[model samples]
Target chain A: MLSQTRYRMLYLIGLGLGDAEDVTCKGLKIIKNAKRVYLEAYTSILTVGKEALEEFYGRSVILADRDMVEQHSDVILEDAEKEDIAFLVVGDPFGATTHSDLVLRAAERNIKYRVVHNASIMNAVGCCGLQLYNFGETVSIVFWTETWRPNSFYDKISQNRKHKLHTLCLLDIKVKEQTIENMMRGRPIYEPPRFMTVSQAASQLLEIVEDQKDSDKESLAYTAETICVGLARVGTDSQVIKVATLKQMTSLDLGRPLHSFIITGHLHPLEVDMLRQFTDDQSILA
Target chain B: MLSQTRYRMLYLIGLGLGDAEDVTCKGLKIIKNAKRVYLEAYTSILTVGKEALEEFYGRSVILADRDMVEQHSDVILEDAEKEDIAFLVVGDPFGATTHSDLVLRAAERNIKYRVVHNASIMNAVGCCGLQLYNFGETVSIVFWTETWRPNSFYDKISQNRKHKLHTLCLLDIKVKEQTIENMMRGRPIYEPPRFMTVSQAASQLLEIVEDQKDSDKESLAYTAETICVGLARVGTDSQVIKVATLKQMTSLDLGRPLHSFIITGHLHPLEVDMLRQFTDDQSILA
Candidate 1:
């Protein structure tokens, strides 16, 4: 049972996307009694802040940034062996590979761990009216700089389209990262967090399409007029879903970070009807 | 806001993948005060029975079978126009297309609806340590009869394997279904519910593999020794994850219903290490 009193176990709880109240009842009960509660802050973000979670949970939450989690997770494990430690994740605990690594670390130290599952973008993308079963492999679109521009995601999208399957694009997030120069100089300064918006991702994808068209027109997967979906602040009250063309997506602003995009391949009539509800221009559906 | 007292709303809540406590705090609050509560049956099953949920939420729950949800949904929508109603699903509300149809129905009747999302097998399959992003299109395996033996899922598995992407196979659940004779006779008799076990799925898949080998050796996707991951009772205290070959899977029995299988395509070193922990025979990893 989860309520075993004698055994002090580590609970990797999932705080479902949205406000503080999104946490499961079982997770909340564990958080209230845990000796130390740490929130993983890099991979994703909730609509609410740490203070809001503290207010609802009646416990102070420690923010475990990328450094603390990747470099000094031993400190987190040390306490978990003696006392019940709550390591909270914004979505499902296993959504990120790093959390799986934490499980491995805890296993190495003979520390027992339990996972509390909750909703994440991997499944919640169905909110846009697309069937989750029809989606192919999910890809990530990172922020590209002048010196480095990677287009590997384009090939995956093209493959998915070839199979008449949809693709979910997880936009990148840069949190608590250091500048290359600062990292080289051993400086502790960190850059402000930046989230890749849908417009930014659409712009990048358009460039890939342009390059592909010039090289091999027959191999192009999507064009400027292809339908694309943009969702922002999913699982929250301000959630927005917009259906438009790739060019239209480049001009569309979803109003906030934590956005995702979907490139469509085949749409059923029901899916088209559902997508029509979120589209501002019915001409796109036509 | 969800707490708006003046507006009567219909809430489609997700009762995660496990027991009663898996429901989000936001969902529990709505269930506590809802005038009428319905639990969807047939698509999935929870580890705990309906009595456990009623005892925890302090409300009597009505079991809404497929007929009630698909045909008599207008009755469910009728009351939501004047009172708060809660329709609880075994997983996330949007996991099934039926729920999406309900949303469209609610829209047609001018009844406001809100969805409280939670974990479903689509995302909770990550418990097996296969990265969620690496999964391709999900496929369903139905109970095959002597006359109707379908093998179309093999092609999809082959496609995913070609892309080096994993495939999540959802086992079929036959609940409250009538026999052909009973349906033809207009009798109300029903067959006992049957949940497809991992062993049954593996046996069926092995048959498909044998057929493929005989007809076209080049088109075969997986052999008998292909790695398959089986998970039973996920998100519960007795959750089980097992990694074995397709032949080995036919001999392994994971207790209880709602079993899922994964066909591995490409495994990262970390994924291999994580999977090794679940595998009984180390030689599989080797």
Candidate 2:
């Protein structure tokens, strides 16, 4: 009890990439001692629910959505000056830049902070049999709209492919977002959360290929037949991995949200063997 | 006890990046039930020693060096066909390619295996405030000999810089490596383990710059004044991070092994601010 009361600091604990049991013993101990525990929920999602975490830790957890985290972060850190405040995040705390912003804000406020590291998607993608060392710049594929289609990620992917390096594409996740019309009227209403599926990302990527072909601009980095690896619910028991061409992936369903897509470059013999477990197309390896 | 006896599979558990307490509750539970626990020791080093991990988990741990992992892996897996065998790895299990080879070997032998993910340097380097998404292909800087100096890593760095993407340079670790003379005599003797320090890596990199300058073959990707980040023993309490120029890093000494170097590319305003806390040279940020 004395150890708990003496230290009044901000703890940014990573929940790893799985269920409640995935929390490190060090992180779990701190969670038990913290006066307040806030689970940041906008950037990522865990496989388990809040009740599962609460049941495992035997502590109450407050879900901090985007508005609460982005706009009212001060409230999250208000009591850190006098008591331990646990700020929990899915995967590693620094996996997303938003958590770093929170850490910097705490530093600006003169509050001490501690980060408990855990497995993040950046490293867990290695489970797909691709070497992490060969991965180049990672890109994010956002949900495309009628007028707002972004393809800068395609250029980055091309750059990586030119160097024979893999590219990790993080799918879009829209949470607590509002429609343009609702926002214009100053409404706080929100749309249902949307987690991009692997098929959607593959389709969007194929569209980019078509767009480039129609315009006949610079030569494309990858074609429709280029190899791709799609990962779903990584780090859980129900995790799924599929390997095929980009065209084949457009119809492949991985059965969950929180999906990640990898557009591979050259594969080593060992990597090719590892990927063989997930795909039936043997000729692609040839 | 029945639950332990029911599962006779192989478990590849990640010890995370810190002390023994960093093991996930799920992993810890598996370790507790394991009939035999082997800690893979060659690819990486942990902050604490074998006794610390053994005491924490209440299990006797066997150190599995490169010889044991590579030459005698069948011996390590002999009992996995009938009992729970916990193979522990520092950082994430898949951080190193060697672990993947072991998994592949197990699959070939018809031994079922499960991977427990944890934080690895690939993602944990984000603690230094460089966004993970901005990183390009990761390269390794091995110790250079007079006649065997390899500069291919330089070309990769140049490629990454062309895209204004940061490069993560993984410093080399030589464990139980035999000297050329000893190997010629068929001796089993070993050299002292050498872990590359930031200053040593910086000096080697400077030599590359000098070689390129003298030959005038290809322009250097980075100069002595380019901003670099040096991280040592990340995910630990006494972890050290320094942000400075490659020239300054040549003289900088952040103690201990397991060092990682970063050659930064373009920096955003927030990234500049995040790097400010580690360096005193404000002019570089300008």
How accurate locally, in lDDT, is each candidate?
0.89, 0.88
- The residue ranges of model 1 lying beyond 4 angstroms of the native Cα positions read A4-6, A96-98, A215-218, B4-7, B96-98, B215-218
For residues B1-286, could you state the per-residue lDDT of candidate 1 as single tens digits?
A: 4654566878889999999999999999999989999999879999889999999999899999888888988877877888999999998988743387888888888888878889999988898788999998899999999999887898899999888899999998998899999999999999999999999999999998886676666568988999999999889888899999999999999988889999999899888988988999989989
Local error of candidate 2 at residue B241 (angstroms): 0.6
Indicate the residue-level lDDT of B253 in model 1: 90
lDDT digits (tens) for residues B1-286 of candidate 2:
1243454778888898878999999999999988899999888888899999999999799999888887888978987889889999999988754487788888889888888899988899998898999888899999898888887889889888878889999898998899989999999999998999999999999877876676544467998888999999898877899999999999999998789999998897888888987896888778
Best by TM-score: 1
DockQ values, each candidate: 0.73, 0.63
Considering only N, C-alpha and C atoms within 3 Å, which residue pairs clash in candidate 2?
A: none
